[model samples]
Target: MNINIKKYLIITLLIFLIVNCTGNDSTYSVEVTNPLDSERIDEFVIINFDQLKITQAQQVNNLTVKNGETFIPSQLTDTDNDGTIDGVAVVLNFKPSESILLEINLNSPEKSKDDFIKRTYAEIAIKKSAEFKDGKYIGGNYENINNVKVPYNHIDHDNLFKYEGPGWESDKVGYRFYLDWRNAVDIFGKKTTDMVLQNVGVQALDQISEASYHSMSDWGADILKVGNSLGIGSVGMLDKGKVIMVSKTDSITCTVAENGIIKSDIRTRYYGWEVGNKKYNIQTDFSITAGSRLTFTEIQIDNEADNILTGIVKHENANLIKQESSIENDWSYLATFGEQTLFNDNLGMVIFYKNSELLEITEDEYSYIIVLKARNQKASYYFGAAWEKEKNGITGEKDFVSYLNETIQKLNNPIKLSYK
Candidate 1:
């Protein structure tokens, strides 16, 4: 079933341009301009057929895209989730200052579609029913779910969620946030690139038992030890040097949107959240892309506050890395790297965003908080982690820092995109 997850946030600058039409025909060409001087890979672009004036014969639903002579697999998406299909999203790789041509065939003969390589996944699963009168679900068949209306009497450790909450991941890493009062985030360090969450926690649906993901497995293990701290970008507000987590919310509703061949996203609304003397409602969106480790967040609240913060857990063994962007109103990064995972191995966690949105950086015994100023009750940022065990993972501090810097630069400079 297709669900409307809201429009994909343009984390990367999306520019659609139509370059040419070879006479009156079903085939047309688009030029994608990579304005950057550095090689960019795994770039994603979406093509709207309607916008391109490309029409298929009545009842035709197939399309094929060619990058020169090479046939590339395209992912069909209902961009607006309006039931009717609108377009296809494709991945690209660009050399510095590259302009790649894409040929779109609106009425291409239907052929058996070759499966695209899946690099991302998202899931929110829970036991189908309560097993006890006290609202405890001990054990039962678990069902993957979406748009869950959180129970009013919900409390932490209820076994109401798989992996404790909604989980989203790319090939490089995995992340999840607690659905209960703590609302903290955590990371799952992957040892393989295959989509593995489905098999990772299938056996521990019982409340009396927990998912075996905590123990080392072939796919990977739950690496972060999130205590009371802002596990990894958990939403909160600063009150007297302490982070007021999303604890006193009257209600919460979660909806899963896209589960990716390209990207995956989930949206949630927290109602009547009480922080200190102020009460507010918040809407959040978290998404990750194929081949990327970053999980980006977009937040909108009913009330504006200057001290809205998100943070990463503290580790005595990790060295803190902070960078101030030289470009004003551009991006900066906050990161930590060291032997901080539950396995006591090398792990790196980072958050990067506009420096103008940052208010302060502070810490307690449990976390290092990046307090942000919310204007118009809105804020956004990206957080991610890397483990040395993952296939082709970032292992050294210098390499990790280079990754962060390159990511920030990419965010600062967007390419020109268009289709004909």
Candidate 2:
């Protein structure tokens, strides 16, 4: 019958060329290594694409990033809030002590989400100004200006509740927390990315309660001189050796959980009392990564107190360099250098202390401390600043202690991630 129908059409074309040349992949493989020999790491490999189904809007072209070179997955949708989409962060740069093997070919067809909406870089703002004051009650108003309220004075001499003060940014930096009562922790020294922390906190609160507008230097001022010290990373309590200072936080809370293409987390919560008498509560999560100048602060503390203190706001004309890290997942830095910052220029402040629970780096007469041990009460720190006037930032203190020992070796050699 025609030679058995030509052998059944050559056995159905050899089973469709062995199922299209064996690429039946639902692929997944992620193994990156940079054990650090000469030091060169710039990582972030996050991948969660809905727990790795690889983005199914038609398989998003199989999401490939083999050999290395992928970024643009940080539009931050649902970030573990469960609803979905907090996948793919990939920024890999490793070398010096390199060990790389990145492949997420999935079954590639080729497509991309290219830098995903530019990742935003980071931002947040909470402004007010209808002009209320020690009378309290100044709810949250944005965009427009009602002279705002809820600013107890620096850390709160008293007035408690009505949380949500304001301040946030990240093209490199910006911060605020003086919403009254000496809660002190202020900074806002930018050059550009200019949103300028709520117009420099309404011109330093109209130059402090209408002294009639002026200072705050055009746009980027308050270069870091947190008097009464412990200004940069704020929070103290080591007792016996003295460092109490904890008030104005009977309650406070702010948010912007995440708003970026690469980074911005601004979460805050600080509830009443801490200074041996206990009953404390502080939760700060602030992250500002996109090329970092440093602002990672994790700090949990529910007051089990094993260790907790932070610093770097002392200035007898700056110059307080202490560094420890003999390896063992490295970390310990407490820097300060020249001109005592704050408009005087040259400012550089640091306080890393990651791991080993960091037990000491103390000093008194207003700041240089870093005694952190709290593991269950949680603790993590990093606060950095460098301003020769921004552009290229850290230009001294040996490049700000080699960018704080390359961020303590990328937080003790992290970026070894693995996935199937």
Candidate 3:
């Protein structure tokens, strides 16, 4: 054979082998069942990639999920930020006691980020070149940042973070917490059902002051006045007969774990948390899913014997309602509804937790709290809010109560995913 012809033939053979090996596609069969008799709307379905009976090795980023021929709102997540996708997350619905079979197809043509409608978002934005006063960032052009250690001098209203601190949201609602001594979570009552957190504080509005996010725009407003209380589900440690905030920490770092089209989360680590002369490390994982009003939390105090607590901020006219689930001791909720929002409109706040973890339900001057005997210093709970002005949302107290009850039922009876 001629030398050039032989070289071309060899190259063509290699290309053919590579295409045959890498271009093949595979589908994973999944059967998801809703155990409850009631219909569940937008139930969060999450499964680890390892659970899928995958026949061929595939890249997680190039995966897609479909119900049939239609694409579903889904994403691959590495919740721990270890650079490896460990799970598949999707939002789905189920009829009364229905079972769903879904296809998780691997090696599908990778979808563009814009191809998926963004139902969830999270961010930590900071100014890069403005000014620092008293060892704190004052003002500058804001930009998205991640995995940053919280400076010791950083304090409340320092303008270090746009809208106080890291914010996360779903299509239903939004949330933010002050990354300072306050450590109180606040709610953003959205008027529209669209994803609005991205343009909240940074985007210029036509009919408001400089900080239009605080004022109600076409999107929403800062609805919660946190003050010195646990505005929503802020974590605390009951020490020396007092529930102290995560204030006295040797060092703290905030990381945006997974900000996505389907889910988003923030991981905050408080190292060497000192309370009552007892030093204990603490970490918290806060996540939100698409089309849901709930923010799920996993708090770790690093001390097994310690009882961690969380609370809903107190409002003058708010009515606190406590309800237990019908399933003996599985799940329950503590909620409050009234004119609690900053707009003087109706708002509802809730905390859903397992009944077994309940240690005490008590109150302070600033908040209504629940103390849980955290197992292994680790506990999981959920916090949520609803605004009456929200588009086609819960309006009255009866509707709010009904919403809470349905949420409790869904939590008590989760869907069962049977892999085929």
Candidate 4:
């Protein structure tokens, strides 16, 4: 045989072997399903690529799930601020029990975006400037409020430090706390695409004390009146029916984790409180997924006290209602609804608790509070607000209670995921 012909035959045989191997290769399979029918789902699902030894960016980038939907490997980071990227977090919409196929092509190009998943996010910001002063109206010199009372009373138009307090927001609602010893939490009703926290924080306060302070539109306004009450899920201790509040949060830290073009999740840590003889700590994690009417608040407090209390601020026009717990679900909610919005529209505030963990429900002249027996030196709960002005917002008391019930159901029956 001629040398050149033998060489060509060897090359052709190698090509044929490679094609056969590629054709027989098995595609990976992963099953992702939502418990609800056609509802958007946002939860942290752990993807253990470690077992498969797929740690590098290129390997993760080539991963796809159902319908050629690619993953966001470029924006991957240590979601928990840990040293390594432990797992993949996803936000997607799926029909009930929708099975998805996961495949990988190490040689394929990386995917730069994951936009098919509709995700709404939450934000938190704290901007502190000593240049604004510490007094109630000290910052008025720097930023002119023009003598207009900010729509939200907790905001001090004069003291920019008061404006420096921590501000949190979701697509459905927004909230801030007075860091200047008042320890009061206030609410901001939202309307537009709420992706900006720093802007919303300054704008909400600025608009209230500006020329249009009195003007109210559907887009948003400082809606909830906090006063000396707990506001929306603010924490205090109920010592023999007397509400005892900490003077202030001794140390505060905030974080914005998992921020993407379409989604965000934020956390605020208000720690080091000296209440009575015991020192306490509070951590709040808020998640606002797309199309959600309420922000999911996971509150954990550290203290030796047997019980911890959280509540809704009482208002003259706001009617307080308690939903009885069912034996099957073992969860109940205390809610308020009525024309309590700063704009005089319907607003709702709710706090959900487990029946087995609840010690009692009590209210004084200030708030409608729930007392939960602290287990393992901590208690967990969810609280949020809804405004009638927002699209598809809670329209009435019934709707508000219904939302709470549905949320409880979701918490009880979370979306289950498994691997094949």
Candidate 1 structure quality by residue, lDDT tens digits, 141-189: 5688867988787677767677778888888888888999888888989
Q: Per-residue CA lDDT of candidate 2, range 45-141, in tens?
A: 5667665555556344235465646433433333433224445555567777677666665545564546343322333344344344574424334
Per-residue alpha-carbon lDDT of model 4 for 136-246, expressed as tens digits?
432232332211111232234434432445455555666666544566667777776544344443433433555231245445766776777888877677775678764
- How much is the lDDT of residue 228 in candidate 2? 76
Predictions in order: lDDT: 0.79, 0.60, 0.82, 0.59
Candidate 3 structure quality by residue, lDDT tens digits, 28-73: 7788999988888888988777677543256555677878777887
Question: Which has the better TM-score: candidate 1, or candidate 3?
Answer: 3
| Candidate 2 residue runs with Cα over 4 Å from true position | 1-33, 36-90, 93-124, 129-134, 137-140, 144-163, 167-181, 184-240, 244-260, 264-287, 290-329, 332-410, 414-420
TM-score of each: 0.84, 0.30, 0.90, 0.71
Collision count for each candidate, in order: 6, 27, 0, 4
Segments of candidate 3 deviating more than 4 angstroms: 1-26, 53-59, 79-84, 134-136, 203-211, 325-329
Model 2 RMSD in Å is 19.5
- Higher TM-score: candidate 2 or 4? 4
Give the CA lDDT, 0 to 100, for residue 240 in model 4. 59
lDDT pick, better of 2 and 3: 3
* Shift of residue 275 alpha carbon in model 2, Å: 18
TM-score-wise, the better of 3 and 4 is 3
